[model samples]
Structure formats: structure tokens, C-alpha cells
Target: MCDFTVAVFRPDDDRLEDAVELLESLGATPVPDPMLAVEPTGASPRDDADYTILTSKTGAELVAGAYPGTDSDGVADGGARTDRWNPGEATLCAVGPKTADALRERGYDPEIVPQEYTSSGLVAALEDRVDGARVEVARSDHGSPVLLEGLEAAGAYVHETVLYRLVRPEGSGDSTELAAAGGLDVACFTSSLTVTNWLEAADERGVRDAALEGLSNATVGVIGEPTGETAVAAGIDVDLVASEATFETLATETVELAAPTYYE
Candidate 1:
């Protein structure tokens, strides 16, 4: 166990209990906080779509959640029903293992999960195939434009639907308390929205500068490269970028960075 406390930005989700257990596994006190609130909207499969793209686990959940009989784990209800469209008939692409797992639980097999867990990675891996294909991307309103732009550049017709909206919750990060308590040991970031929302929350609490200063002193861990880039662009010094853009990897790397002799 290291001498640092691990702070996480986990939005209100069903997996929060698992997250807490994960944080505790690293032998540190966990301060799990929600920087953004996720609200899933009504979104479903399209019959005319040639392929399906899911960028996050939330998007996968939303797609399955829209249909009757499909629960969060994709379990069939007593009289679960699906649309006339067959998800199995369409090519499924997920950004990472967690996202793919979500789809798999819904009985949809993902054919494309990039070696790198990111939009650019997905594009790079499927660039040669997306040309002349019609891709249906289910994502949040805060999703990156990179996927859509890259697919369009590859001459693929894209039909994107917003499956969720991310809103900043009432209270933000406790930078004041953290800074006053000798700063944090690690700060976990899940997405670009998490970073933006944290900054906004801090600013709203009139502690943006103090928050940034505290973060600059702590190790910043990002789920993916784009998120790390977002944090850096926002004047937040970054320390760890997960090799795999998954929560498990993020937690592992955060704990590693917090080792007693990590910076020594």
C-alpha cells in the first residue's frame, strides 16, 4: 500500500460498487466522486444500417436498454422482445474490451475492437474496410467528432444517434479539502467530459486555480490518449495514460504510480 489517496471521477452508475472494490484493492483510501451525470436516451438499432459502432459501455447499454426484455446485462426478460432489425446481422464495432463485453452480454458479437482502445485506433484499424460502408454510431452527446469525421473521410456514410446526455452534477470535486489536506495522490479520469466537467465544477466552486494546482501536484491517470490530451490542454499536468483504455487498467496504473518509491 502506498501513502497516497486515490481520487476517482466515476459518474453515478450501477458499477460503482465494483469501482470501490477495485480502488480498495490497491491499498489506498478511495474518494469516489461523480463529475458528470449520465442520462440514457431512447436509441435503437436501424434496419438500414450496415454496421454498428459503440464507443463506450454506456452506449452499448443504451442500445440494448432501448429494446424490451434486454436488461443491463443483456439478460432476456420474461417476454423480452427485439426490433425487426437483427443486431447479429450487422457488423459490430466496439472501442474497448469493456464496451465489447457490454455488447456481448446483449447477445451481439463485436467483430472489430481495435488494438488501441480509442476512436483513432478504431479508425486506423477499420479504415480499409469502412469505405463505401454505412456505419451507425451510437454515442453520447459529448462523444468525440473524430470517429464521424474519420469515417466520412473514408467515404463511409455515417448515421449517428445520441444515446445519452452528460450533465454536470450539483457538486464538483473537493479541491479545497483535497488541497488543504495535502493534495491527492492520484486523480482518475475516464473521459474528456470528466476532465471538462471537473474543471467546470471547480470553477463553479471558485476553486479552479486551486484545483488545477492540486491536480498538477498529483498523478493524473486517463482512460485513453484523447482524454489525456484533453486534461493537458486544460492546464492539468498528466502523469499516467493507461496502456489500455479500460477502467481496470486505469486503476492498476494509478496504484502503480502511487507506489512508495514510484517517483523516487
Candidate 2:
């Protein structure tokens, strides 16, 4: 029996570790590639907005800080920071359950979490309510333009604060070489940035065409439709777009599709 190798591009933090663990548990050889690195921008969400939106667990942690007993009442002393973060009367909104949980861990009670768990879904969830309302969006620099455009189109006065920037980690292209060698059975992309970064890394390594060819032969999975579009635009055949926009869903579906016998 051959090893079912699955390549995952996540950050070096617990996310990457968690991805490896999930892949291993699903009976696949995990290619742990830390593609995304987070850089804090020392910025926090505007508290004066009528509705404050947080797009990811990383964003929530950056704004609220990761300290014990440091609920959203006071400014956290870690990650991104402002003088203070007192929501006062702002209704907190999270893009998904994990982000909402991160906010809750920091003592924030997010009032709105869309069922679809995407930027468009959040926009739809707030479309009727945000008209003429001040909406503050806080997230990474690579956050989707759909979020801001949707909010603006819905008549919301939207302001965005870059809480962090995501960059490709140093020496992160090993997976490109592996993929180009046709050693991977599956590759999971969590965001459009990951797809762009992977290709950029491949280009830098002078294996862009070979890597794309290899991905064509392997099962390529993206977490969301936006990511799928990015992959397709790059000429990478997408084998699966997870029904849910989550790592577990993406990995589980990818592993099952790539090697159903091993996954079972």
C-alpha cells in the first residue's frame, strides 16, 4: 500500500499543527507546509462603529489579545492593540463560528454570526440592518474585497482596519517541490492568498509550470468558492471545494476523495 500524501498550506501556528494532526488521523501522510505568516499591525477595530465585524479567529485574537481574565472590557496587552477597546454599544459580528468563539474567549459577545460563514453571507445577514449604519471591519490585510464592497453596496458606511498582514513564511516552498515531483495525493488550499502564495513560491523556485502540472494530477481542494476561483484562474484543477469553509471539512473531504480506502 502506498502512503497517501496530502499537502496542507497553513500558518506555522497551531493551525498548521492542527492540519497535520487532522490529516494524519485521516490516514494520510501530512505535508506540513507553513505558507502564511502573520504580522501584527498594532491596530484595533474602531469601537465607535454601530456594527463591528471580525473576519477570522486571528483577527479576533489580535484585537482582543490572548490574555487570561482579559475580557473585552479592557484593552488586551498582546497582539494588535489600541489605547482601549470598549465596544460601549457596538454590536459585534463574527464571520463564522470559530471567529465567534475566539471573540467569546476574549470576553466579547458577538451578536451576529451568519449561517453561511462567508463574507457574502455576512453581508446578506447584515444587508437590511447596516443601511446608513457605521460598520467597522477588522481583519488581515488580505481580507476579501467582497466584504467591503458588499457592505458599501448595502448602504453601510464601512471602514476597515488592517489588524495584521499575511506573508509567505521563509523557506516555505518545499511543498511546491514535492508537488512538482508528483509526490502529493492531495493539496488543500484554505484561502485565495494561499493559492497565490503557493504559486508565487513555485515561481520563485523555478517550478511554476511543473508544480501546476503536478497539481493537475493530484486532488486539489479549496476551502471556499473564492479560493476555488483563484485556483481555477491559476490553471490549477480544483477537485473539491469543501461544503463548509473550514480546515476540518476541507481536509476530510480532500482525504476522502483522494483515498477513500485510507480515509475509511
Candidate 3:
């Protein structure tokens, strides 16, 4: 019955809301809130592209703007002329189930979901098979170019779309203030951007030290090795790295790290 306090820095999202619901179900109280929002940087998919590579659900959702049913979930308008978009014969590569679910919701049947669930994993899964193919990669505005470079090195022409950008809402960096109030037990990071955004917010709010001190004492859980690196770069102490790079896994690891009583 020891409900631990936690923090999440992803864009406000239904899937994230679902993950938080799962965490709450595990007896955690998320702090500074998980309602952080990521804004799309006006990138659109090409209907004529030979292949579509979705690294995250965010990429899938951004690409969905071209589809009929999922237009509302797509990146905002004026960014791309997706009206006549048709994904004819284009192969879809989803990084994981979450991305696949988003693709499916938008009437796409993902042809690839890398077993490893990471950028390197995706490349390993498709590189050998996509020789001479033109692949479009959709991801966050600040997504690493390793996937692009890797695909190109493997002889696949890669196109990248900036699906979204993480930005703090006006006056949003009260994380340190929240943690200083005490009771926050877990600090959760879902992506490199989350780590960057949290640190930026903390610094902007002039409470970087307090936030760092507070989080240093908390069980810090990151979604993957990259996220762990980002957290460390942001001066966050990492105590847990999810075996898999997924929010679901992050939540599970969080439970084991911050509230083992309910982990099972």
C-alpha cells in the first residue's frame, strides 16, 4: 500500500495517459505531471515513398495525418499537403507494437516491427532486405540521424520527417518545486527528449539544483540505453534501465524500482 510518487515528461498523449493509468493502477502518483506536450515541426509523409519507417508511435501518429480517419491525430495542417496522400505499395516499418497500433488505427498494416524495438534494431531488421529502396523515416524533430545514416550505408535511400518537437507549456518548469515538496519517489524518462526537456525546464525555472538533488534521491528509470545516456547528460542519476525501450516496460521497471511491493 505504499503508493510511490513518480514523474513522466512525454507529450500529453492518450497512450501515455493509458500508461499513467497503468502506473496509478500500480500505486504510483505521477508528479510535475505527465501532461508535457510535444509539438510537430510541420513534416509530412510522401505518398509515393517506397517505404515508411516509423520509429515511435509519435512518428506513426504524425504520418496518420495523411489518412482519412486519423487526420485529427495527424500533425497540424499547413505543414504538409497530405490531401491526396495514398500509401500505395509502400511498405510500413514500425519500431514496436505501440507504433504498429497507431499505424493500424490509421489503416496501415505494418510490414515490419523490429524484434529489438530500438533504432539499431530496426536497421538490423530491414537493412539487408531494403537494398536500393527509398525509405521515409518519421520521428521527433530532434531524432538521431543514426537510422538515416545506417539505412543509407546499407544502400537504402532514406527520407526523414520531423514528426514532433517536445516543448514546455508556458511556465511549466515547476518540477523542482514539486519534488522539493517531498514524497516524489520515482523519476521516469521515456526518451532522450524527455530527459532534455526536463533538464531544460528545471534550468529555466532556476531550480535545476533542487530538481537534480530531488531526482538524485529518487529511483530514476529510463526507457532505454539512449534515454539513460540522455538522463546522465542532463545530470540525472539513472537507477533503472528498462530491458525494452517502451513506456509499458518503463512502468514495469518503475514499479520494481520505486514500489517493489506492487511489482508482482
Candidate 4:
């Protein structure tokens, strides 16, 4: 029996580690070759507002410092503001358990709402709460305006703070890492950017066809609907989608889909 190989495109080592551990436990091997690199934006802090909206774990980590007693996992210090709107109930909201646990460790019991775990879900959840409140959105420097835009459209006072930036991984001379992913049994794309970066890297390495072919035979898993759409746009058929928009769920579903082939 051949060892099932899975390609993970997330650039965060911590995330990559968690995915790899999950896949391995399910009888799959992870091929580590990230396509994106997370860079901090160094944006100055804005005024403390009524509400703080965090979309990504990266953003959570950056602003985690601002909310002292907030651990790396998004936990807030006891007695700190705890009415913040955490999309995934703090767990699946930002990055993964670590971020959620961090928030809890600090002292916050995030308001978890049952819904799709994504920026859109967060927006929908905030519609009623932020209609006339001042909300501050903290995100990556290159983050999208989707969340903030939606908030304002819903009559909320939205202020944005850039916390980080995402760029192509540095020191990677070429897209060789992507080219080598051609033989994997499954390719997991966590974000729309991951899809773009993967394809871009493939094109740069002149292995577009190879990458596509590799994807064709294997299952393509996406973290969210938008990411799934991005994969479809890239001409890769997504076979599985994580129930929740989180890397952990994405990897779990990917492993489950490919289990028959690799796991007994």
C-alpha cells in the first residue's frame, strides 16, 4: 500500500503542524510547501471603540497584545471586555483552537453564534448588534473590505485597523515546491489566496497542467464557500468542503474523503 500524500498550502507553521498531525493520524503524510507568507503591516492602533471585530487569527494575534491578558490563543484576561463578537464562538473563528483557547485563557467568554464560520457569517451575526454601535475591525494590512463594508452598510460605525500583510513566501527562488506537489492524492486550499498562490506558483514553475492533473485525480478540499468557488474558478473541482471554515476542519474532511484510499 502506498502512503497517501496530501499537500497543504497554508503558510503558518503552527497551522501546518496541526494539519500534518491530523492527516498523519488518519494515515496520510503531509507534503509541506506553503505558497503564502504572512507579514505584519505595522499599522498604528486606532481609538478603543465600542466593538472590535477580528476576522483572522493573524489579526487576532496582532491585536491580542492590545487586549492584554489575551493569550496567543485569543483568551482574554479575566475582568477584561468580554462582549466582543467572536464568529466561531472563539474556536473556529480566527485560526484554530489555539486562538480560541487563547481568548478563553485571557478571561473572555466569546459570544459564539451558530452559523457559517467566515467573514460573511460574522457580518451577518453583527448586523443586529452593530446597527448603531461603533465597531473597530482589526485585520491584516492586505485584508479585504468585505467585513467592514458589510458592517457599515448595515448602519454600524466601522473603523478598520490593519495588523498584518500576506505576500508570496520569500527565499523561495522559484515555484519548485508547487511543482513537486503534482503527485499528491489530495490538495487542501484554505483560502482564496491559497488557491491563487498555488496556481500562480504552478504557472511560474511551468507545471500548470501537472498541478491541474494532480488535482483532478485527487480530492480538492476548501475551507469555505468562497475558497471553494476560487478553486472552481481555477478549474479544479472541489470534492469536499469543511463543515466549518477552519483549517482543522478542512484537514479533517480532506482526510475523511481520502480515507478509503489511505486509511483502512
Cα-based lDDT for every prediction: 0.76, 0.86, 0.73, 0.65
lDDT of each residue in 111-164, candidate 2, tens digit only: 999999899999999999999999999889999999999999999999999977
Give the per-residue Cα lDDT of candidate 3 at 175. 57
What are the per-residue Cα lDDT tens digits for candidate 1 across 126-152? 789978988888888987889889989
TM-score between model 3 and native: 0.87
Best by lDDT: 2
- Judge candidate 2 at residue 63 and give its lDDT: 71
RMSD each, Å? 4.1, 3.3, 3.2, 6.5
Residues 1-264 of candidate 4: C-alpha lDDT, one tens digit per residue: 337777887765676677778778767778777777765544433545556655655555545453333454444444233223333321222323445565566454444442656667777777777788777766766555677788798898877766556776854313334434656787788888878877777777777877787678787788877888988988898999889877777888887877786545
Candidate 3: segments with Cα more than 4 A from true spot: 66-84, 260-264
Predicted structure 4, TM vs. truth: 0.79
lDDT of 3: 0.73
Residue 41 accuracy (lDDT) in model 2 = 71
Please provide TM-scores, in order, for all candidate models, with all chains considered together: 0.86, 0.91, 0.87, 0.79
Candidate 3 pairs with clashing backbones: none
In candidate 1, position 185 carries an lDDT of 74
Error of 4 at 243 (Å): 0.9
lDDT for residue 38 in candidate 3, whole number 0-100:
59
Output the worst ten-in-a-row residue range by lDDT, candidate 4. Answer: 86-95
Local lDDT at 42 for model 2: 68
Model 1: how far is 77 from its true place, Å? 19
